[model samples]
Target: MTVQPGRRLLLIGSGWGAESLSRQLREQTNPWQVTACSGRQANPTSGADLLLWLLQEAIEPNALDHELGLWRQQWPQTPLLLVLPAQHRYKRQWLLERSVEGLLDQPAADAIAEALEVLAAGGRVIELQPETTSQHQRRGQGLGHRLLCSGVDQIERELEQINAVLQLAPIHPLQRFVLEGRRRELRMAREVLHLLWGQEPIPQAQASAPAEPLQIVLANRKGLTVLHTVEERLAHAVASLDEAQPSPLLALEALLPDRRRQLFEALLLEFRLLVERLQADPTVASSLWSGQQPLLRERALQQLVGAYTQLPKEGALVHLGDALVSSSDLQQEDPELADLLPSLLALIEGRPLLIDGGLQAPDEPAALLHLQRLVSNWLIRNGELISRELLNNCSGWPELRRAVLLPDLLATRQLDQLRNRINSAERWHTLVERPLAIYESRRLLFDIQAGRVEPTMVCDLRDAELRQLSWWQQAFTLLLEARDALAPQVELLINRVGGLMVLLLTRVVGRAIGLVGRGVMQGLGQGLQNAPSSGDQRS
Candidate 1:
């Protein structure tokens, strides 16, 4: 049969299974140009629109990652649809992060057809829901099982290496998180290896029901059922641990055992108190605000205006520093803090403050040099309350809220108050650049997704780091503009100091990159943890 030209698919797999799939594709009313291959062989003669990677059930996590990487390199523009076993469903997010388009778990030809349709339309099919049926334990001594065993061996070696290093030198706090995360991956991989070999620890008796209704028990080992539950359920089940003998499986859980218990207790107590309080005053919520949602804008409109009103209007905003000689003066109880209430010394930071028109440098030249320092000290005293209010009130773009606006609000939310007191002062606008910032940030993210900007561009910089970089870049440019205003000697001095500052800032950028690298490593380990394998049998 001469199948009509249609969407080209490169189906990478082998055997009778591949033949059956190809036959199904040919039989479809909208036939596709299918090229099937054993992964060991070369790719198709022509470039494909899409890739269908049919990974075997028992493929090791590490091996799967390598194969995916190769496919991505080979077909950078082509979207990949992974046809995987039900056991490998846990890898969906890991695959998605690497730009895999769709996942069809234990797919029928119809499921494959549906997934392809979605892909053709530029939509994603993360995982096709399979019909509920009994899963029989697979039996085989296949290549995948061998690879699994090898992967487990590699993980075990890595664990030993980490343990040896830890014994010799105290690991940094950040490094410890990475180490423990790796340990979890090793244990999970070991479990999968045992399951593949039919050597998993057997449970004496199966429970009629999972102990926790919300929990999904994967395996029962040495009288302890390794289960998965949501964050909320984890909170209620702190005391449910069954005194199982110590093993490497619980290494991640070992950290903060005491702190976790204390936290659980505290939360439980707080909930009880809240319930009792609600019972006592059934009308408190109504009396508070009549259930008109405590939106950030409303809170900002009220408290934000009130807070800003306390800043001094007249001369010597700088001299307020001398009056705030003692830390206690900033506190409510101190007379000095009350007299110089919202310390002007604290809020002014060198970065241009947003107002009605555009960015404004401080009126006083001295204020420019120590703007950030002043703001930092003020926030040190009164920041917690301001932060709590803003956090509780806002929605959307949490990074923008926390990093940019929180400081903006801290510095200038009260500027309107200063304007009201003295008509000459310009009103500090709340969320002036916020709307624009949100749009630009989202646009940048979109560009990354569209492949215009590489993910690597922001991979090293967290949202805060990116925002800070943008701010510094603008600040440096603004300072350069002011260079012409100063005397030649002053301009030279400024140039030298500015260059030194830029060099120091580059160190921060390097640190952010290193932090991101560590985080990526931790995430890689985390993804490998809790993968459902043949060993994960439930009665």
Candidate 2:
């Protein structure tokens, strides 16, 4: 049956009520068309917006399951309204599993019409009549209620445990924060449930989370490149040293083959030249080195290895020359050749020119070294404080603190892996302009450390929030101390100062002070008269 030219409604079942449902559906003012089919012949057809399954009588089990499964498979998007007997009310869970939209307790013509309209408008209706319960029914309802409360309480406990860990977590997790909020909401729900049932207060929350905070640091590109190139070489050298046993020269010789030596030497020459360029731009050089010269030297050495891996030949010098000196006149003059010749000559005989030029320094990668210092300091200061907050017995998670700082080192190690991920200039700018400036700042710093961009480029991306936050923390701490120190004496100090000023303003004090002041003024005038004038001295 067609009612209107808009949404289509499919009615399936063998029932006299199916005819009633169909007629009622036709009364909808919204455009709708209806199709009536028997439960035995219930098959999905095109463009059905809603399905009404009216079962006036129970069907055979195997056939009913098969037909429902078939409808589900075919018209999964269509909302289904089940109209069945009171006995079938137990089938509520079964119908829900099948994605039934509405369950009408009694198949009334008016109710079916309203349900269809509600389903059409994307609302669900489950209208079940309240009935007087026997002792068994009451027991069953109480069991369900207890089960629900148990599940909710368990979830709250779990969330509480997670929040305990998060309290000590070095990195702030949005997911954990959201879970904490949900736990509070669940607690409120349980309180409401208690109030509604007029029961005793809910049992105390017994969930206890262990003090095991997890931490992970994000790696940057330059640090990764350094790790891959220089760190690998150091690992090889160390391994070779261990194997060669008492023959350090043999290990050194084994590790530094002639081809690798040449590459190293060429790289040293480029580094020396690069240093000259950086020195000329002192501002850029100072920030890049960050006054940690040993770390800077290590970075340069790592970049040297990267340069060799990429270029691998002496001809790469041509590219380096072009990068440094673009003018034809300067190129013709071959100033690079003149400048690098001394470093090249020194390196030819295995006297690493870096020693002379101050580029080669034996040290840990700067990023990791810097991180170690930061972590160590944090442990000494905030570690105990956080430990107190996290657990009464335990001190702190020293391992987790190190892990938190590992991102700087990890980013350096993973530079090559993330080069393509955060390499766009436009992407960098977009991140800078984002409202979460502090997070974006860290992300961009990771990119720089990863070697996705020039270390020099790091100077351009500036967000003062993290720095400001640090300053604010210090200032706030000092302000709190000052307020506390002055808090008790503040009123007394003000009153005493006010009382002294008031006494000075009184008539008796003024008269006594005036007499003394007049005598002093008269003495000063007499002294001036006795003193020699400039004119008399000159004459």
Candidate 3:
């Protein structure tokens, strides 16, 4: 009697023993036509009788689930025969629940063929051994638990560092408040770790709250569950590091009583008004706040306003600019004005305007009106440029706009003073202007040599060496070096003495002479009035 042909079987795996399996099935008396493919390349085909998925050892549960889902989607009606490792017999129930018709433990070619035949014949076959807890699984679980413990230890170390800073470091009150809030978050993260470790029971309040359905499969290796939870919690903790924490200062304010709270509120109001006033005039703000004691200035501001406001520690000026933009009607007039305000504020504050991770130029004509208004307001209130010393130190945008605009703004008030001196009959400009110019030149040269202004451009004097020259040239160069070194000091002295002379002439001498002239004129008029008139002489 002739044997009938076996049904078609689709073999899917990593191609490890797929060819051998296909050959073995083909050599059978009633050979089954086998089509082998990798898991990623497996697709539905017409007249596919059965699917035999050879599961790799140590395969992640998520990956297996994803493969199984793809198999189901491609072949909804086709019977599935899963060839699992003996170690993964624990996953039999999971495979069965996922609508797998057959499960075999590391099945050989004949066994796979038999399982496929049974599945094709509409019968279920489960050759896997009953679920058992092995030593290897216990070791894996122990390692996972240790890893979670290590993560908890790491978090504890970070918390300890924060506590050390709070205890030992001389930090701002606002920094203290922020650090305390971070401490609370770390503490909460520690609680989560403890709960996951099963060392602590869930709180009654939290237990009473409705819990989300557990997505983790119990049939999956316990170690894998622990690893997944650890990964999720660690990621959450890292994300929380960047998130802004709630201010403890606000909580302290909340705890204060009515009278003190009212006083605190008033104090905060005054601080806000002060910040607004400072923002309105960058000159006064820079003079008062931008100095050697920046830390103290920031701390004072934080102590005053941290309770009511959430300002970033680094960019307090930017925060003030944001507030200014929000309070103005510029946004109402034009939507783009709101966007342009930040760039404008940065320009006036002598900071670089960044857009899309690059320096941006403020070349828009529409911004001109607003820029002019801001500058005019500053000038009308007698605001001066942020100290040239500060400007020389900061290497901001080197664009033509900044280079031109800043110098022009500086020259406005300076030129006005120069004009007044030139118009004076005293001719004080001869002595004052030249000394001031020399002092400024010397200062600029010093700044350039010290690597403050125009850092990319090297100073000619910086690399010059008298030793490299001939003897005569060295003598002349030595004189030049000494002169170069002493010029700044000499010019500074001259500038100071010239300033004193100008003050003496313009204020003391000029006021005294005007007083004397007014007195003489008054006395002469009184004498003439006291003298007898012509009519009185005739009488």
The global C-alpha lDDT for each of the candidates, from Candidate 1 onward, is: 0.45, 0.44, 0.47
User: How would you order the candidates by TM-score, starting with the best?
Assistant: 1, 3, 2
- For residues 1-539, write the lDDT of model 1, one tens digit per residue: 56554488888887788889888987788888888877744645686887887775657777777888888888888878888766563432344344466766676878788788777665556543423322232223456755665666687799899888667666688888787788888788788777776553222122111211111111111111111111123334434433222321121122233422332334334333333444455446334222322222233223322333332323323222122222112122200011111122122122343322344433211222122222222221232233223333222223323322323333333423422332221111112232233323421110111111111111111245335444644464345556656668797899999988888778887788889999999999888785666667552
Work out the TM-score per prediction. Answer: 0.28, 0.24, 0.25
Scored by lDDT, the top model is 3
In candidate 3, which residue ranges exceed 4 Å CA deviation?
A: 1-6, 40-46, 136-539
lDDT tens digits, residue span 128-186, model 3? 54445443432345655766667777888999899899996678999999999999999
Once fitted onto the true fold, the runs of candidate 1 whose alpha carbons sit more than 4 angstroms away are 1-6, 40-43, 89-96, 128-539
lDDT string, candidate 2, 1-539, tens digits: 44554468878865566676666666656545778887534434456888888776676656667877788777877777777665542443344334456767665677777677766766556554433223343234565566656656676687678678767757567877786787787778777766665453332122211111111111222322222333333223323322111211111112223322332343334444554555455445545433333333334333423443332123333332222122112111200011222332332222333432254311212333222222222211221121112121111222222222223323333432333332353254333332234433332221011101111112222344435445544465456567888987998899999998888777668888999999999999999999999999999
Give, for candidate 1, the lowest lDDT window spanning 10 residues: 446-455
TM-score of 1: 0.28
Count of residue pairs whose backbone atoms collide, per candidate: 6, 16, 0
Write the number of the candidate with greater TM-score, choosing between 1 and 3.
1
- Compared with the true structure, the alpha-carbon lDDT of candidate 1 equals 0.45
